[model samples]
Target: MRKLRIGIVGTGYVTDCHYKAFKQNRNAVISGMCHTYNLSHPKYREKQESLKKKCKGFDIKAYNDFNELVSDPSIDAIIISSTNSLHFEHIVAAINNGKHVLADMPVVTDIKQLAAIEKLSEEKGISIFPAHNFVYNEAMKKVKALIEDGRIGQIIHASFLSSHSISNNHLLGWNPNSELSKGEAMFDSGHHLIYQCLYLLGKPVKISSFKSKTILKSMDCEDTMQLSMQFVNGAMAVLMQSWSKDHSKMINGIRILGTYGSIVLTDALYFNDKKIMKMNDYMESFVRLSKAFSDNILKKVPPLSDLNAVHEILEITSNLYKTAEIESLRII
Candidate 1:
């Protein structure tokens, strides 16, 4: 069995997660990595050393130029863990180079870019799977199964609340200036809630949202967002996300209201209020999806989370942003 050689295009924190996930998969190998910053820098060096120690068996090379990593003939797949802004370029380059791509959330902020990628992917015959890790979570998957099985009956309404601590220090430490823009909180964190909503109840025909910057006054991007979606199935969803919380533990939870019963999974389904069953940890779902992706690549099976589904999620988020802007202007 030929190991799938993967070249990662970012050496930042989230790249560590991808590296660890790939390492756990026996069929995948981290062939090389690319970063704009010099790996010799103290911070970069520290990260490189840590990654080397963490990924013991993998042969990892750090490159200053992205093209060098993308053009590597040995790399069969690419993970675009670069800043949100660079995802389009990196993913397109990989597809042109005949490599499968796994990009992090919200591939692009604009619909036009997504459309271009969609067209090119079909032409190139390569797969571009957006890493919506939450979909793979065991608790969420069980909830999906229960809903489908009529255990929850008809889902009448749903709500999701996700809050994270985003102090100036936190933003500077994780997402540097170059990596994020004025409205990245919504684009970044909001995408998770939007995708989860879409995953639970297909795409919404209409979406309206309110996005604001409640904390870190200097930052241009929003630190909080409130979104309301009306699905074609007549099921409505309310999603709330914020970077203003000072809480230590952080919060990510969802509730689905149905005619028969209600299901709740907080912190990726690890905590459940119902006594019937326990929710699986979030990491377990990623492992399952990783194995599924590997099997699909080997056997020519369709991916569980295909590009079309991803495109829909992206489009819905884009619409939500537009709606947010309109609402903001009206309020002003």
Candidate 2:
């Protein structure tokens, strides 16, 4: 059996997460690293220098040009940790070059890009996996299993809250004002909650959302967002995201209310007078996700992070942004 030769694209903080996961999997090898932006840009230079320092112990080639990385025959697949705006272009390049892709979430901003990628991927005969890590979480896996087992009866409503402190958005290359940014807290952080809801429940038929910049006024995008979705299964999903400095990491979990009982996932999974402690570390989710992706590639099975799944996520997110934009104007 031949090992999969994978290249790391974008070399950001999330790149380290993928690298850690790749190192643990015996079936995958980190063949090379590629920074999507040119060295002329400070961000690119910083990332390249940081990548060099990070890759000291490892033996891997560095790619200055993305086309070169995509065209390399030795590379079988590429993991794209680039900015949200660059995903479509990188994915198109990889597909055209016949390289499999595993891209970070909010894969593409527009629904048209999603349509194009799906068509291109089918024509190219390759797989494009979206890095939706929450779906692969062990604790979430237990929650999914219980839901599938009908332990909670008919799911009535679900609420997901993801809160964190604001970071240096510029260093992270996240500018909601720039075309490069996918969106503010909703597209950046809220994608996780939306996808998790879709995974546990079903596709949402309608969406209502509100967004505001309550704290981080420097950025063009909102720092907080609230989204309400109505699923086809007659269930409701409420998703909230915040990057407020005032929040000292409050309830970051999912709560599903059903006819029979309820399930809540926080640091631990609790239901029916029982508690299942989560993994010691969250990195374990990336480990399992990487293994699953590699195994699917080797076995020619479908990846859980398929482009279609990402398309649905993007569709939901797009609607949320649209609604929020309209509501923000009304508020003003």
TM-score of each prediction: 0.85, 0.92
Candidate lDDT scores, in order, read: 0.73, 0.80
Summing lDDT over every window of 10 consecutive residues in candidate 2, give the lowest-scoring window. Answer: 169-178
Evaluated against the true structure, the overall lDDT of model 1 is 0.73
lDDT of 1 at 123: 98
Error of 1 at 189 (Å): 1.5
Model 1 vs truth, CA RMSD: 3.7
Query: Which one is best on lDDT?
Result: 2
lDDT of 1 at 58: 48
What are the C-alpha RMSDs, in order, of all predicted structures?
Answer: 3.7, 2.5
Give the per-residue lDDT digits (tens) of candidate 1, residues 1-332: 88998888776666776776777899987778766444456676666565556445445776546787788898898888776777788888888999988877766646678889989988998877777777777667777888888887888898888887765554665453424541556667777787777777887887888877777655566778888888777999998888877472444678888888888876444213455556566566567666666766677766656667767866766677787777344454
Cα lDDT for residue 214, model 1? 74
